[model samples]
Target: METTKRGKVPLYLWMLLGFAAGLGGGLYVNLTGQVVIPEVMEIIRSVGQIFLRLLFMLVLPLLFSALAVGVAEMGDLKSLGRVGYKTLLFTVMVSAIAVGIGLGMVNVFRPGDGVDPLLAQQLLAQGAEGASAIVGSAPQSIEAGQFFLDMIPSNVVTAASENQILPVMVFALIFGIGMVMAKSRATDQLQETLQGVFEVMMKLINLVIKLAPIAIAALMFNLAAVFGWDLLVRLGAYALVAVGAMAIHMFIVYPLLVWIFGGMNPLKFAAGVKEPFVVAFSTASSNATLPIAIKAAEENLKLPKRISRFVLTVGATANQNGTALFEGVTVLFLAQFFGIELSVGQQLIVMLVCILGGIGTAGVPAGSLPVIALILVMVGVPAEGIGLILGVDRFLDMCRTTLNVTGDLVAATVVSRGETDAVVPVDEPLPAVAPPD
Candidate 1:
């Protein structure tokens, strides 16, 4: 019931309170060995589910509208080409580096060796039925050429309905390109409408974000009430390794990029990004935090509106450095847990899959789980091993999402720096205004 000057609790405080209460409640339940009624737990979980669903509902519309407008706003073919190439190249290279770091950390730490086999087996058994259902529906194998082909949806409506993000992205990109090429009055009008829709979607996101504190509290409480401390103890090393890799990427890698490529002070870059980072960490959704990230880049970071719009919007959908890193660490941890000794080639394939999966991953909570499960199966590791990390994933999701948004902002800054036309002068006025208008 604590309220800030605005008469509502600040979001960060709300999330912190939720997390603390959940942790306390969970520990109490575990120590006392009291059974929470299943029905009551279900109600709590339902609140969290509703929150997740609300966020998911916005993903497609937000992606399409933002991407389309961002792309169309690029104006001409040549400018679009230059910006697109730099943005994507930077995104892919950074994401690949993140995966490399994850692979290296997991290999060195070998968190799987610390996990008790009996505990792993028990965890596997407990979630076997759900895991089986996941594997039963998973693709038998992923083909390289087919992956590209599948991205071109036969029916975009079907893709949106089923939440096939990659295909939807492909559709948006093509639609945006067409709009740019047409260069007609109607096309301009449509682009304006899409931009308006993008703004509306952001407003809706702000509305839904108000529910986050209670929803996150319910989620954490449910997780604690159901799983307890034993699982955390067992997977502590694996969790540490995953989190540590993300930390390295965030604290070390990103700053280095800002200082080196962006020619900006790393400390200043970090300071500028604080607002978006908090929203991203608390919500665990890059798409949900897109509007704030854009605002930060333009206002605090002084990135050009053109570059920030294109890079950050596309990055929200495709450049998932943190998710890529987590998937790499996760796949390796599960492989080690099951005594699956992957060859060098297999490890490289795992790296590739994770990088690609990160690009396609939706910017929502636990969005990487299904992709992780699929990679596990492709590597002949038990898809059921997903059960091992599910308990700790929500917390890790928060960490990785922070990295994801940070990486996007870094890409925007670095890429903007490279474009002479796109770099706003450091001494430029914050809100440029005509003096005599």
Candidate 2:
């Protein structure tokens, strides 16, 4: 979890203050028909843009390093045997379901729609330069065959330069897989270096996020200034949909998986995970809650240490069902907000990226921001539109993070099922290993 370093006020509180202030200012301009000074407005927009550009600058390095290290950390899958294969499969399936739920909810609710077309056009105009560049760069029509072919970047550097996110991610996954296959002192050193890179990127992201309150205030002021009270209505609807989707996945999908596959009663499973769930929600960070989660799995849930440790540790980074869901909904919602209609093929592409992104996204507060930003650009949505959702993100972050942590436990339980030695009684001492002879 990100602590409120250097300030007494919690970051979330600061962010909410920024949101309230910006919303009030925007509402004043809208209700009173007061004209905002052109220069002042320009300055506000510039602040938001600078913050956004910083995020864009970090996307490739953060994505590549975080993803490669996450994969390599899984170690040799062959050695892991059934536990490894099952966990990997479970991660993918659950993530796919998560993204499916998010996309489905957005499609049904269409909260991003129903905005005034004139206001939508105005929003586009404000972000015209960057939006135009993104739109111009994306292929006019994304065909199925060509899209699959494009996943393998002909030149990784060129793909990265062009912000071809899918190709770049594919390269990182393959590179990480190669590292896993060829384990040696050299590979170990490389993994350590990549881990170091990921840690540095995370720290950099934390620093950048300190500016979020100011940036969000500016972004919201710009948005509310133009869109008026209607912006508030749309934002409320978007939040409702996001929270609603997460609720269903949390209460419904996860429980069902636990009941059927893990042979654990829903009540028992819920009772066992309460500690981790509370810690996860309060901290809003999977990384921060990992130790508690591991403890809950072994002592509370009575899961075998080996399965619990491996699954929860890997799941901390690579099994982010909640992040995947949030990214999917956010992307599709933005596309709808900007009046861009994505084809079925395009939506599927979004799904795939969200699933892959779930695995690669960092397990910290605001970790999903860069991934969401890049996805918006990929789908021809104005990345600037992200500001529209920043106000509500802290609350949503907490909610989705709860789901992420709980999902890890669920994965552990299901993976542990059918193993002959699934649990070691909490009261019983484990067999000791002899010292190296």
Candidate 3:
């Protein structure tokens, strides 16, 4: 009971903290000339980078255990197909909506094109790196020839063991559906062992979550120290519009989605996810928070255990409306910044690519950027635009993570309710027990 009260940190307190620190620190750096210290900046960057790397390291093991357990426990072939179809369809449609929001925002606000030409050139020139990592750039090097075929995993064990979510999902999914075909005795036994192990791993990850505040504080500070406060204001109008659109999507649109589809009170659901919001804000990784979000839906909403389990595990990979939103907005912003007039064909590409990209994004840190770089190339946006955003990506990441996890929760809730139950398919039906021997 007491725990709930502590969760409500007054909004003004946080605003003040952000304001005072940003205002004071900006003045100090500009006054003392200490912002450019080579050694100090390096240490700051190293700390944040280390934390970011550690957060990503948790993805494979977490997914493996969660997906394996989620699928094995149910062993329900019928529900598996139904659930998978709903998840994929929802992800695609919502992702397109997110792209539309981005298009609307950048077009209205025109954040990028407003930058002075010289600053635009210099921003492009700064210690910029491509947004993508090696593994994330599928649109370019992946070759459009075999996109669908590549999604089907040839080797189940290799895929899961390697943490390839698309293939791992394919494998775990088929194995669960097949295993459910076995007699009840076998499925029951398999589920018992997997659940036991998964619980233990979850506890360990919780400890890692405790480390997140420290990591995030260091990360935010480090970023502020190097970029200087001016970076936040570089394209102030553009950032505001993007952030504002994300806010409307998260607070207004997502909640409305929940009410319309799930018939649940949006305020209660939001209140329930407060802890997740904080974690999502700090850690900025939906893949990392899958376990927590599932637990919240199960515990707070009293959702059927299996319902939260399967829906959320799958949602972590497939449902990413917030990410779709970010990718769309960022792409358009870059086009505007470079004064590149996007033809109708180019805008269409952004819309389609972002929708797919949001779905394809792995549930890990910095996972979306590489894919963004690939999309830039597809639409003829200079790839170097990626490096331009890296400086602020760390900060923007916090906001995006909140939306991603929140959207998953909303999707899970809605999915648990079938047409009979208001179309929320987020909860699980009680497991059937074996007949008396």
Candidate 4:
């Protein structure tokens, strides 16, 4: 029943409490140092699995309506084109910074060396098995130019059905571009439909976010009851580096970007950005956070509705700096853990994969982790290292989401200031929380 500064029991608090519960469970397990009961573990895992499935079930509809509405808000291709380019460019650059920081720290600190050799062997063996599970996997070992061709949506509905967000986004961009070409009357009709769908989705999203604390509590308890928190220690420096690098990227790198790029005061931007920031951090879905972000940008920051609608929507899809960086660092760190040396060629592959992952990874909770896992596997890294980070993923995901939206808002604000009609309102309302669809 606790509330945050903006009001209500914020979503991140629920998840954090869950994390704390899990940590406690972990501590008890480690202290006893006893064999964990298999039956109990299975029950916990089952519950966690159910919760995960619930979370996944919510992704498609939420994304489809929200993202489509987000795109449609742009009104025309010229605005869409400009916002899309800037958003993508900024996300790519920041994502590169994140991954570079992660890879650099992991390498410099040698975080993954000397992990239990047995754990390494077991994980490597398991990782290969995991790789075999990829049936219709995205292509690998392809020429660089081919990646661009492949990124286009060969089938938009298929992309949507599969919840393949990157391709869905690509389709949305093209669709929006085409919408802009149509007459304004037709566009308005389409926009109205999309908006209605979005409004309904927003209501759903708000409902789900309300349950966030419970979900977080459940997840944390299950984690504690089973694997426990001490597993993080086994990761040693790798864990430290991963969390540290992400923190630096989120709190430092992002705020700096806002200040430098927008000429806005860092503290003010950070303060003003909280409502959207908390939602992004809690839901870990910039896509989910889109409605509130647009509202905040337009209503609070007084950004022109056209600009807010345009830039914020594109930012949801293309401006994913956090995912990019997370992919970059995790892939390299996994390679280090498995003792696979990443040559210059491999590093280039890593960079390329991170860029693509940044573009492709969704804003959903722990969403990027799965896609990023696939990216690591493509580069000959052990994917099981993913499990090492998976337990903490929900928490880190919150942080990544914060960076993602903050970057977006900063982009919106900076872009708006350049326009003559852009206005900054002194009164920014608290974020709207209806339900998670």
Give the C-alpha lDDT of model 2: 0.85
- What's model 4's lDDT at 198? 50
Each candidate's number of clashing pairs is 0, 0, 14, 15
The better-scoring model by lDDT among 1 and 3 is 1
Tens-digit lDDT track for model 2 on 1-437? 46686758888788888888888898888889999889999899888888878887887888898778777766556446668768878988999999999999999999988878888888887786765554334543577598888889999999888888888999998898788888888998998998888888888888898888898888888888878878878888999999999999999999999999999999999999999999889888898899999999999889988888988999998899999999999999988887889888889888988888887777656878888887877767777888788888888888989999999999999999976454556799999989998
Q: Which stretches of candidate 4 lie over 4 Å from their true place?
A: 1-81, 117-119, 133-231, 278-302, 422-437
Which tens-of-lDDT digit does each residue in 1-437 have in candidate 4? 11345766555566566656655665576467766677875565445444434434554454455445444543445444455445545555666776777777767777656555664565466445535443124334446576566558788777655555455555655665566567478777987786566566545544544554444444444434333343455455555676788788767876777677777787776667678888877667788788989888766676767666777777776567666666676777667666676765556556755655554444344445445555565566644345455445555666667777877887787766665444435597666889989
lDDT order of candidates, best first?
Answer: 2, 1, 4, 3
Query: Quick one: best lDDT, which candidate?
Result: 2
State candidate 3's TM-score.
Answer: 0.57
TM-score of each: 0.60, 0.93, 0.57, 0.60
The global C-alpha lDDT for each of the candidates, from Candidate 1 onward, is 0.72, 0.85, 0.60, 0.60
Mind sharing the TM-score for model 4? Answer: 0.60
Tens digit per residue, CA lDDT, model 3, 1-437? 00013567532233334434544554466456674567875664455444434434554444444455444433355555466556655666667776788789888878776545654454334313322221232232233546446557787666545434445544544555456566377767876665565465555545443343344344344334434444456446666777887887887888888899878899888888887778777767787787789889887866656667777776776567777788888888877775566765567656765665565454544556544654564454545444345445556677877888888888777777763223435576766999999
Model 1, residue pairs in steric clash: none
Give the worst 10-residue stretch by lDDT in candidate 3: 130-139
